[model samples]
Target: MAGTFYRVQCADCENEQVVFGKASTTVSCAVCGTTLARPTGGNASIEHEIVETVESR
Candidate 1:
């Protein structure tokens, strides 16, 4: 199956960004530079609020 993606809202700046569910590296907020997601070797550890889930086809 295709990997999933998540729309996360930054807690500090409320910036909405699309992040891979299995991101290999750390993901930061686009506007605020806050840590939004962290690599966990599997699904990324989301640090902010999850706005939506994106499915790959």
Candidate 2:
């Protein structure tokens, strides 16, 4: 299966980050150190709002 990338904005600090859609571990914000997404076996459980779907090259 191919992996997907997401552009998410942090709820606490308004920081933007790119995360893997099928992440195996919890993802955090780089600026604020807040929880952004958690692994959910399939797609990651995102805590922040998804700004856009990033296209991989």
Worst 10 residues of 1 by lDDT: 48-57
Could you tally the backbone clashes for each prediction? 0, 0
What digit string (tens of lDDT, one per residue) describes model 2 on residues 1-45? Answer: 688899999999898999999899999899999999999998899
Off by over 4 Å in 1: none
Local accuracy of candidate 1 as per-residue lDDT tens digits, 1-57: 568989999888888999998899999987989999899988889999999987664
lDDT (0-100) at residue 26 of candidate 1? 96
lDDT of 2 at 56: 52
Instruction: Give the TM-scores of the predictions, in the order they appear.
Output: 0.90, 0.90
Cα lDDT of candidate 2 equals 0.92
